[model samples]
Target: MCSVTLRPALPADLDALSALEQRCFDSDRLSRRSFKKWIKRQHDGLIVAETPERELAGYALVLLQPGTRLARLYSIAVDPSRRGQKLGEQLMDAAEDYAHEERRLYLRLEVRKDNAGAIALYEKRGYRLFGLTPDYYEDHEDALRYQKRLHYQPADAARLHLPWVQQSTPFTCGPACLLMALAALKKQTPNTTEELLLWREATTIFMTAGHGGCHPMGLAIAAKQRGLSAAVWSNQKGALFVDSVRDPDKKAVICALHEHFVKTCRQESIAVHYQDFTATDLDRAISNGKIVLVLISTWRLDGRKAPHWVAISGSDEECFYIHDPDPGEDQAPLDCQHVPITREKFEQMRKYGQAKLRTAVVLGA
Candidate 1:
C-alpha cells in the first residue's frame, strides 16, 4: 500500500469515477451523468478513495431516505489494482459512517449473489442478507439484498410492535393482514381462526387466481361483525375484484357480494371514506394508536401481479412499518413482519386494482 487517502467526491471527479467503474465491472455500470447527479444531489456526498498522488482508487454513492432513519449504499466501485488492499472495505465503512451521522437507522445494499468476495466482506462488516431479487442485473443475474440495522433514537418509542402470522392459504392474504391488525390493536394474539372466518365473510366470488380476495367493504363488514370498528376508503365504488373475473357467472356472484357489502356497510354505519389514500393518513392513524390493513400489488414484492395485503404497524415521515401477512422467500429473512418501506415507495406500492386504487381500512379498538 502506498499511502492512500479517503475524501468526498467532487464534480471534477465525475469522469474519473466513470473510468474507474469501467475498470472494475463488465456491465451494469453507471454513466458519468449518473455520477455527476449523485455528486450534486446525494445528501451524503459521493465518497471516494485517492492515492497519495491524488489518483482515483475507489468511490461509493450513498442515499439518505427522507422522513425516516434509513439509508442505502446505492453504488460502490474500486480500482482493479487496489482490489486486495481493502479499499472496498474502507469505502464501505466510510459510507456507513456518513449514513449513521445522518441519523439513519439502517444501511442497505444489493449485490450479485455469485460475488462471494463481496458477500463475505459485507457479512464481516455486520451486514445481513435480508432480501433476494430475481434477475436484478442487466445480465439477468440474481441479487442478494443486505441490511445492517443502525442504532438510533429510543428503542421502544421508535418501533410499533405487531403480532405476525403468515397466510395459511394462497388467497387468504387479505384476511390474514386484517387479523394481524385487529390482534395488534386489541393487544392480543389470535390464531388463524379469525383469519379463516374473515375470509369466509369477505372473499369475493372470483379473483385473478383460484379462490378470491377480500373486498375493502367486505373487510369492514367482517370487522364490524366481530365487534370492531372499521372504516373503508376506496378508489372504485362498485365491487372490487369483480372487474378482474373473466367469467360472466363468476362476475355476477362477485357483484352480488359487492352489493351485500355496500348495503351492510350502510346499515352498520361504518363510514366509507373516499380518496387516493396517502401514507400521511396511515401515519396519523398509527400516531393515534390505531391499526391499518392495506392492499398492495405483490408485483413489487415478487415480479407477480397478485393481490396482497399488509398490516400497517408504525409510521414516520420517511417510512411505513408493515406487518406483511404473506412474506415470501425473499421477505422472510428480511423480517417482513416489521419491514420499513420508504414513504414514497409505500405510497406507490399501495396502488393496486385496475383503477390504481390506493385504499386502506383502519381497524379501531
Candidate 2:
C-alpha cells in the first residue's frame, strides 16, 4: 500500500491536479478555464496526496452550494497505477472528512449511471441514491444523484432538520404522543420467560416489517437491559417518514442513537444492516461478531411519525425481539424492553413501511 500524505492544494499543484483529472476522466474534460472556476468557488476546497518524492498520486475537488448544507464532489481522480490500491477510497475519505468538519449536513455527488465501480464504492460508503438527472453531463449522459449523511448522532440529525430541537421550541404534543407510542410497545412487552418469547416474536414482526424497526436496535436494547454494552454501525441518515409537526431529518438522527450506543458499549455485540444499505462500511466497523439491525420503517404512511425505530435481537423458533423506539419515553424501560411480533406480521408490516426510507446498523470494525 502506498502511504500518501494528505495536504491542502496550492497554485503550483494545479497543474498536477488538472493532469490527474484529464487522465482519469473522458468526454467531460475540465479545461484550464474550468479549473480556475473551481478555484474561485468559495465554500469549496481542493486536496491532494503526494509520495515522498512529491508526486501527485490522487486529488479531490469539492464545491459548496448556497442555502443547502451540501458539498458537491466536483472531481476526484487517482493515478491509473494506483487505481486498485484503494486510493479513491482515501480521497473520498479525505474529502468527506473535510466537508463534515466544516459542518456540512450532507455530501452530494453525481456519478455516471454506468460507472459501476464508482457506484459500488460510493454505495459501500453509505451514499444513498436519491434520483437521477437526465442529460446532466456535457455529453448528455444521465447522472446518478446520491446523498451521504454526515451527522453521526440522532440529536445532530434532529437538530439539523428541526432546529427547534436545539432552539427549545417545546414539544407541545406532551405525554399523549409518548403514551400512545409506549402503549404500542406495552401491548407486546414480555414479563415471563414465555412472555418474553411471545413479546420478542411480535416486536420482531413489527420491526422487520417497518422502516427503522430493524433488528439491530432489538439486540442492543436487550443487551442494555441486561447491563451489557451494545454497539451498532449505521449507514443511512434521515428518517424514512416525514412528520408535519417535525422535520423528516429527525428520523435519521433518532436512528443514529443506536450507533452512539454501540460505540459506547464494551461488549463484542451485534451489527445490523440491510441488503441495499451500505454493508461494507458496516462490516469494516464490526470486523466480525456483531448483530445486524434491519431498518424496516419504510412502510409508514405519509405524515405519520414513522414507526421506524426497532432493534432486532436474537431469534429462535419461539420469538425474536425487535427493538422499537415508537414505544415513547413513558414506557421505555430503564434499559429497553424486548417486544415480540410474529414473522407473518413482520413481513406484513414491511409491506406497509416499504414506502418509506430505511437503513441498517452494525458495529464499526
Global lDDT scores for all candidate models: 0.77, 0.50
Best by lDDT: 1
After the best TM-score superposition of candidate 2, give how far the Cα of residue 85 lies from its true spot, in angstroms: 0.8
What is candidate 1's lDDT per residue for 25-136, written digit by digit as tens? Answer: 8999988877887778643548889897889999888876433355778889888887888788888888988988887777888899899999999999888775677888
Top TM-score hit: 1
Model 2 lowest lDDT segment of ten: 159-168
**Looking at model 1, which ten-residue stretch has the lowest summed lDDT?**
152-161
Candidate 2 Cα misplacement greater than 4 A, ranges: 37-44, 153-365
What ranges in model 1 sit over 4 Å off?
1-158
RMSD of 2: 19.2
Model 2's lDDT to the true fold? Answer: 0.50
